[model samples]
Target: MFKVGDHVVYPYHGAGTIQDIEEKDILGEKLNYFVVFFPLNHVTLMLPENRVKTSGLRKIIQPKQIDELATALKPTESSTSKKDAARPYSKENETLLKSGDIMDAAMVISNLTSKEGERTNGLHMEDRKNLDRAKQFIVSELMLVNDLSEEEAYQFITDNSKGA
Candidate 1:
């Protein structure tokens, strides 16, 4: 269970602070929940205490792990032909993001992000959505772990993703 004031990555919702833990009656059962508040969106999320693991809630990745992720981002390359099959690749990226492995997530984003002269019309809409999802996951996690603003994180990732 997460204690108050802990920084946590809340999946696609990005990073949030655990403001409080409260017990509420639901269907005659008392349930303990974490009240997480997102500073970016100014929203609150109530997460079931028992479902944290299942829901993919996790602590911020360690600084050493971030270094590993940065190293992984330094060499982002994917065979476009292999990714031609949209659904499978997209699903794979989604899984990578959900895994909460920053390096894998960065690889997925770098794979999907287009360069200055690159073309994207050939890519499927689903693939684009998946790419956005993966980028969001990585950016959000990076922001929280590094204590950076969203814009800073985006710019940093964009700059770092070029040759990765």
Candidate 2:
């Protein structure tokens, strides 16, 4: 279980610190919750303590894993095909975004970016939205794990993804 001051990732919300754990009374029930504060989004969330696992909340990637994350961002042959066409509602990408896994986020970034390269008209509005969201997830974790500012984290991802 995460404690106050721990850096953790909440799926689709990026990384945040567990600011506090408190018991709250709602609907005549007293339940424990984690008060998570996401600096990137400037938002705080109250997550039920018991749902951490199912909610995909987990610790940030360690520093040693940074190299692995970089690898995942590198441009690669995308699995996206004409049938999938990198649609905004792609189930595979949606699942990756919700997994709260750094590598998974990287994969979405890679796939979407590559697909964008293959298109002349650019990404659809929703596809562009998904790409931005995936980038934010990576940026959030990088900011926490690498002690980076938001600008630095974004640049890091961009530079790494531009490589092979």
Top TM-score model: 2
- Residue lDDT tens for model 2, 1-78: 789999999999999999999999989989999999999999999999878889889999999999999888987886
Question: What residue runs in model 1 are displaced by over 4 Å at the alpha carbon?
Answer: 80-88, 114-122
Worst 10 residues of 2 by lDDT: 83-92
> All predictions: root-mean-square deviation over Cα?
3.0, 1.9
Q: What is the lDDT of candidate 2?
A: 0.88
TM-score of each: 0.80, 0.91
Q: Which candidate leads the pack in lDDT?
A: 2
Model 1 per-residue lDDT tens digits across residues 78-129: 4455345343367777777777666667777666664211443455666677
Itemize residue pairs with steric clashes in candidate 2: none
Clash number for each model: 2, 0
RMSD of 1: 3.0
